[model samples]
Target: MAATSRDVAREAGVSQATVSRVLTAGTPVSEKTRARVMDAMARIGYVPNRAARTMKTGRTGTIGVVVADLGNPFYPQLLEALSRSLDASDHRMTVWVSDGGKNQAALDAIREGTVDGVIFTTVTEHSHELARALEQRSPLVLVNRTVEGADCDQVSSANRQGAGLIANYLVAHGRTRIAFIGGTPLASTTAQRLGGFSDRLARLGHPLPDELVAHGAYTHESGCRTAAQLLHLNPGINALVCSNDLLAFAALDTAKAAGIRVPEDLWVIGYDDIQQSSWRSLNLTTVRQDVAQLAAEATRLLLARLDDPDRPAIRVELEPTLVVRASSAFAPA
Candidate 1:
């Protein structure tokens, strides 16, 4: 038979209520008492069941994380950061891929009261399916994306500023005929980036024409197709700014296949400086989004919202820095 909280209390020479309080998070138990109770529970091999604790405290000590796609290396990095942050708060994470077949399972977990709160890591635009989730009772937070009038808090990078930096870098390096490849045009992220880049380029007197812009999913295949169409079909596009590292990687490979020398005949810049961007092979110049910081801020928002359900919604936009590399290096005149 498993050792129960009663056994722990007896071993610790404390009331069962005291042991229960120690098991609950954010309880006002004294440090000395907590330590003594923990030591006693460990010596007695006592472990409280999650179900009982949830019934007592009304908190499952679990958080649901809904990621739209994990195929991208960036998602995995974000997931790792979120896991670290959640663990630090003594919360366990249960993940479900929004685009995966198991999406219904995520909804069921919420309906069945399996998770305490939720974090939507990929809440992009035109997400009709998420309309239901947005109305759910869970104290949810959006990470890296947000919708207008969203009732939840959000944590994202300064996308517009990052995009402006790219535009400036390209113009400073003397690239005039630049083209942009965006992801999900209606998405707030894509809109902000494209708008910022366009505004900054126009201000710098290297205005991007309507014909030079392309839109597609934030996938390598999509970027490859768009890049090929632009490089082969369209003419005079000397610089390519991609929405994400995966797209930029695709653009680089496509440029090579077209026999174009990067930084000599053309230049490429991308957003979200993913790990692969630094590989000697890719050597991509891009915007660095602090994934760890994003995760931490999102966790903070979620925890705070859960703590104070009536708190006003907050939006956190962390600053992004440019990561220059060979991909966008200026050629000697």
Candidate 2:
């Protein structure tokens, strides 16, 4: 038979309650008692059930991560960063993608006290579920995106400034008749990037025309469709700024299929310098968001909120850096 806490207690010459105290985190057990309990468990090969402990302490030791389409490499990269951060603090994560922008099952778990906290990476302005969580004062943090009028801790990259940098780079490279491919219309990152790119271009005396702008999901399919649409509508366009790297790659493929010469005819730039962007075949120029920083800050904020739910909400924005490569700029011959 497998050894239980009762067996451990008997071996340690301590009460079962004392054994549980030692097993649970932040429970006050004397060092000597803890040491004795540890030794007893080692001898008996005993392990505590996490679910029972969660029932007793009301903490599942699991953080809920609400994300978007995993098809985007950025989410996997961010999740990896978050996994490292959570593992360091002895916590696990359960993720649910925001399919069709409805995540009621995940929210139901939050209300049922199944998770210690939540981190939202795909929140939008009209998220009623988020508003309900806020009203209930749930321990949550927003990463990569934030909802307006929602008082919550958030961590994100400087989207507008990064787009401005793209505008400057393109203008300096003498790119005229520039076009834009944005993410979903409701996504805050798309809004910020579009605003920055358009506003900066306008200020530089190269205003972006509405006809040259297109919106789509952060997927390659959207990129192909939108890029093809823009190319067909205006063959004179000299550059295309995509909201995300996946879209940029799709645009590159679209340009290739249309027999459009890159750099010699059109320039392509994207956001989020995903690992695949550095490939010799793609060599995509993009704005690099520090996924590690966003994950670290979100983890820190959520843990802090869990510890003290009454604290004032805070927002942290990390600056993005422009990565120049063969896609946007010509390589040295």
Candidate 3:
């Protein structure tokens, strides 16, 4: 028969209850008793039943992460950061992409109490599910996105400030005919970026014309199509500001196909300084959204919510830095 806590207690010469306490680390045990139990377990190769432990503690040690699309390169980087952060605290992550939090998988996980909490990487402004989750006081955190009226802990980069910086840079560089490509209108990220860019440009006495502003899904294909649309509609556009890096890449390719010289003729920049942005072929200048910091802060907020569900919601916004490269500036020496 496999060794049980009883066998461990027998080998350690301690009471079975003492062994249980040591195994669960629940009621503190004396160092000597803990050492003895641990030694015996190592010798007997005893593994505690996780399900039993969860039943007693009421914590499954699992976190749920919801994202709109894992196919986006940025999301994979975000997941890697979240995984590393969670692993450090001895927690596991269960991810739900595609439909994000709107689908049955996430609903089932929450209803079945499989996840201790949820982190939303993508939440639309009109997400009724998010509103319900907030009302239920579920242990939840929003990362990189926020719902309109939902009250929950949130972690994201300073989208408005970053976009403002880009606008200033482009205007100062003598790029007058500027255009903006935005993501979904419902996304807070897209709204903030567009707001900041437009506000800053207007403040500089050069507002973007309505025809110069276009919207697209946050996908490469959408980026290409939108870039073509902007260029086609406004042939005089000398600068293009993309809501995200993927769109910037598409603009780069479409501009090249349209026989436009980058930097020399049309300057381009984007947000979310993803890895591919630094590739020699692309060399995109962008606003850097620190995925690592975002993941760490979101995990910290989720863990805090887990401990105290009644804690007041908090928002953490990290500042973004501008990375200037060949896409928006002259090549460096």
Candidate 4:
């Protein structure tokens, strides 16, 4: 026979209402009472009926996380952070991987009433799909990306400032004829990074030429292909700034295959500073955005929004710092 809340309360010598309060986190109970109730639950093998609780509270206690590419190491890092933060709040995460914010799966997930809110980790700039999500009246927060005119809460790193830092580092180190490898142009992260890097270079009197700028899909293969083309077809690209660490890793290998000495013959830098960037073989110098902090902030914003749906949309941007490594050492004059 399944143990009910009544059974738990009886075993713990507490009223049914007291058990309800403890389970729902409604009010603070003394530690001793909490321990007694918990022990009773364990001994009786009591499992709260989540469906009944949802019916009462009108909240699923689950948050939907929409990611563009699970393959990108950056998204997984953000997901891990979000999961941990949400878990602390007694909320579980349900992940939905969309194809560049253009898939029916995300809308279906929302419509299914499976989650109380959503966290878009890959919201594209000027995304209609995100607009639809906003219209759906789902309490959602954008993480690491945002639409230009969307009325939604956002948490992200200072992409422009971080990219500018890399540009300055490359230029100050005497690397001329620099090139850029970008990910999805529609992504806010890509736009900000490309804009910042190019704008800063222009201000430094080294405007990037069209030939030196290439686009990729934020994949290693795309990075390898673009890098090979840039090195073989173009001329005198002394430095390459990739949009993310995965691309940078591919560029590193491609550069080596082409017999181009990194940092000595060519400098490379990337964003996100993923784990692979620190591996002994790569040693990639990249921009380090505090993904865990970003996720935590995003979770907080979403919960707050859920509490007060009419709250004004907030945009939180954390500062990003550069992590230097062997891939971007100062070039010799």
Candidate 5:
């Protein structure tokens, strides 16, 4: 039979209630008694039942992470950083994946009190039910996506600034006829990037031709289709800015198939400088978001909320830097 709290109490010559109290540390216990309980637990190899402890304390010591599309390469790196940061604070993470924007399972998990806090990414503004559920259950932190009119802690990169960087780079390289590829119209990140890109282009006395911008879901197929659409609409376009590296890769492949010479004939740029961006074949020029820093900050924000739920919510926006590569033309000397 496994060692139980009763065995620990018997070995320590204390009541089971005392053992439980010492283990939880919910209330102050004498140092001598705590030491005695620790020794007894060590000697007996007694492991407390986490579920029972949670029942008593109403805290799981676990943070729930809800992500949309775990398949995205960027999310895995972000998850790794979040896990490391939470581990340092002695908190465990329970990851949940939502299909696209459907967060029914995630909402259920949160409502059932399975975790003390939640860090979510890829939520849409239309996620009313999920948002309401989170508001009722536990402290919530938004990562990489923000819900409109929702009051919560949010950590995200400056998408607008990053997109503007790409636009400026394209313009400076004398690519006046540029096109935008990738991103679902409903996605906030996509909207921000598009807005910034258009605003910057207008400032430079060059407006994005209405037919040149293409909106599609973030997928390789979408990238290919969008690229084809842009080219068919405006063969004069010499540059394309993708919403993400995946889309950028797809654009590269499509450009190759269409016999478009990269940098010499057409330039491509992407966002979120994913690891695959540096691959020998791709070498994509992109906006580098500090995934590690964003994840760490989100974890810290969620943990702080768990420590004090009454604290005011905060929004942390990290700046992104542009990484020039072979895909884009080099600046004039």
Candidate 6:
């Protein structure tokens, strides 16, 4: 039989109320009492029943994270960081994959009582249903994307600034005929980054040709296809600004297959500075979105709202920095 709270309290020589306060309320119990309770729990192998606790507190103590395309390397890193941060706060994460579609199934998961709150990524223009469903019951935090006319908390990177940095670097290196490999245009991240890049390029007097701008689905295959189209439309394009690392890597692969020398013949840049970007084979220059900070901040925001559902919505945007690497390096003129 599993040990109960009563047994733990008895063994710890403290009242059950004190133990509950120490664990749930985070009330500072004396070190002696805390040690005793911890020792008792260890000896008896006591595990608090989360379901029972939820029934008592009316909170699931779990957060739902909805992301688009788990296959994208950037999201996996962000998810891992978020899970770690939530665990440190004594909360668990339940992940839901939104397969690049604004479907009823995803909205239903948010509407039904599956978790306390939700962190949404990859929201598209068609994500109004999700916005409506989330607004009805639980606190919703938009991660990396936001819907127009939606009232919710948001956590995202400064994509526009990061995109500008990449554009400036490319232009400084005298790469005038630049092209953009944008991801799903509906995604806020993609839209902002592309807008920034285009705006900066136009300001710098090296505007991108309409034919040189290509959109993809944020997948490697889509990146490859988009790169092919961009190359076909503007074969003399000197630089490519991909919206994310995965797409950038695909662009690099496509360039290599087409016998184009990276940096020497074509400068390729990516965003989101994923782990693999620094690998020896793919030293990708990209924009870095502080994943750890984003995750920890988002977790903090969600937990705060979970604790107080009536809290005003907040939007936190972290600045992204440019990381220079071999992928975008220019040779001496």
**Top lDDT prediction, candidate number:** 2
- List the candidate numbers ranked by lDDT, top first: 2, 3, 4, 1, 5, 6
Residues 1-333, candidate 2, lDDT per residue (tens digit)? Answer: 878899999999999999988977899999999999999999999988777777877888899898888899999999999999988888899888878554566667777877888988988778888888789888889899876657999888888899999999888878868999998868878998999999999999999999999998888988999999999999999899998899999999999999998867888999999999999888999999999989999999999888899999998889999999888788222
Report the C-alpha displacement of residue 17, candidate 3, in angstroms. Answer: 1.7
Please give each candidate's TM-score: 0.90, 0.94, 0.94, 0.90, 0.92, 0.88
lDDT-wise, the better of 4 and 6 is 4
lDDT of 2: 0.89
Give per-residue CA lDDT, model 4, range 40-119, as digits (tens).
Answer: 99999999888888888788889888888878898898889999999999999888877764334655665776788888
Question: What C-alpha lDDT do the candidate models reach, one value each?
Answer: 0.85, 0.89, 0.87, 0.86, 0.83, 0.83
lDDT of 3: 0.87
Candidate 4 lDDT score at position 50: 86
In candidate 6 the C-alpha lDDT for residue 245 amounts to 94
Off by over 4 Å in 4: 6-43, 100-104
Which model, 3 or 5, shows the larger lDDT?
3
Candidate 6 error regions (>4 Å): 6-43, 100-113
Q: Give the clash count for model 5.
A: 0
Q: Write the per-residue lDDT of candidate 3 for residues 1-333, one digit (tens) a residue.
A: 777888998999999889899866458899988998999999999987677778888999999988788767899999999999999999999988855435346655766878889888988787777777677777888899876556889888888899999988987877879999988988888998999889999999898888899999998899899999889988998889999998899999999999998988899998999899999999999999999999999999999988998898898889999999999788222
Residues 240-331 of candidate 1 have per-residue lDDT tens digits of 99888888999999999899999888888898998999999999999999999999998998888888988988988999999999997756
lDDT of 6 at 257: 92
Clashes of 1: 0
Q: TM-score-based ranking, best first? A: 3, 2, 5, 4, 1, 6
Candidate 6's error at 128, in angstroms?
A: 2.9
